[model samples]
Target: MVRGDPIDRRLRTLVLLGLLLGLAGCAGGAHRLPYDSWRLGLFAPNYMEVWIETADAVDVQDRVFRRAMNGVAAINTPKNLKGDPRGWPTRSGAGAGKQVLGADLPRLVYVRWQSLAEPQTYEAYIVIPEATRRAMVKPETGYCPARGIWREDYRDMLTVGLAPGGIARVWLMGGCLSAIDVVRVQGTVVKKGPYGGKSGGQHRPLSATSKAYIEKYGIPYGSW
Candidate 1:
């Protein structure tokens, strides 16, 4: 085959074009981000029960990005408080959780809830730090697995705590049942409502075990 032959030149051009196309495909894939799944958990102290109304994602400018929950009728504290961190109640139903893509990562989470201790609906905008979001995509390693199974579910756990007088707390679950405090957003009364309704419920005394747990560890905020 001659160096400048028409047939040789044609083959070289086709090979170069194929290489360029392959490179372009790789670049596109690198920029594309994978979807991350998340579930909501809650912590309420002093036998306080909280009813979650809405938990939505907002952008930096406070624009609604995604509505995670809307009047889902879910409780923060479970009926049976066993004093075990793992036994805490997380919001159930299809809307209690969300799957977010990288491009749609929320800068803040707007949460609204009603507590039996207050006669009004309380709302707050919880910030999701850029570091936490980045960690979500690339979770830390070196943590031992549970029973020989590496649990990836911790990366998807987001817990919210409610206290009397419109106090709120937020945390992102870390590996090995660790809770990393994201921030505490003080709740503000958004609207007035009847003291007793869907948000109202019969108060029950904390179990002996749960009382002891709280006595020792204080209110289970981000820890569980």
Candidate 2:
């Protein structure tokens, strides 16, 4: 497999840029950012450290993921029977509404991001776990490319699809999301794939079910 640019870098930049927009517009100005060829840059990042909190707003602590935010290692599960994989499939939080296949299987997710343009400031999110580290480590496109622009799709901060890298991917969602789904998020920024060997758009569209949820709840998700 041909190697591509690091996925982490693009993610770092996108995260920073996204936060930049939030910071710049928090006082309520809305506009667009100029440069748009999304790809990995040379900006060394600080891994936007955040306090991962649970559904009830309890902070999540760990030896790895929440702390390290790195690694592809596994932990021994509740029961370890011979041939029984003591692990769960990946999925999102119950608070994010119904479970989603391939979503990060964490109690909750927190985000911290910085960009070269806005180095001094950082933005954070205490949203549902939407992705996994492996999805970043290995993309079908090999390198992490700038997949889309962070724009508003309805009232939500949507990462609109721009293009696709010509490789098929299997996002190894951990926990209850073990069996990789047909689609996955590349980072916190955008969604990807058709599983197996098919190429897909940059992000998945809001399904009719999702629209219904939005109509009832006013937002696709609830966050703090």
Which candidate's TM-score is highest? 1
lDDT of 2 by residue, 1-224 (tens): 11213224323443344344342222232122221211110111011111111111111111012221211111121211112111222331111111221221222222222211111212223322324322322323222124333321111111111011111112222121122332322323212221111334222233343234334434211111
Superposed model 2: Cα runs more than 4 Å off: 1-65, 70-104, 129-224
Top lDDT hit: 1
Candidate-wise lDDT, in order: 0.48, 0.22
User: For model 1, which pairs clash?
Assistant: none
Q: Tell me the number of clashing residue pairs for each predicted model.
A: 0, 10
Query: Which RMSD does model 2 reach against the true structure?
Result: 21.6
Evaluate residue 136 in candidate 1 and report its C-alpha lDDT on the 0 to 100 scale: 51
Model 2, residue pairs in steric clash: 4-143, 88-175, 88-176, 89-175, 89-176, 89-177, 89-178, 90-176, 90-177, 90-178
Looking at model 2, which ten-residue stretch has the lowest summed lDDT? 37-46
TM-score of each: 0.53, 0.18
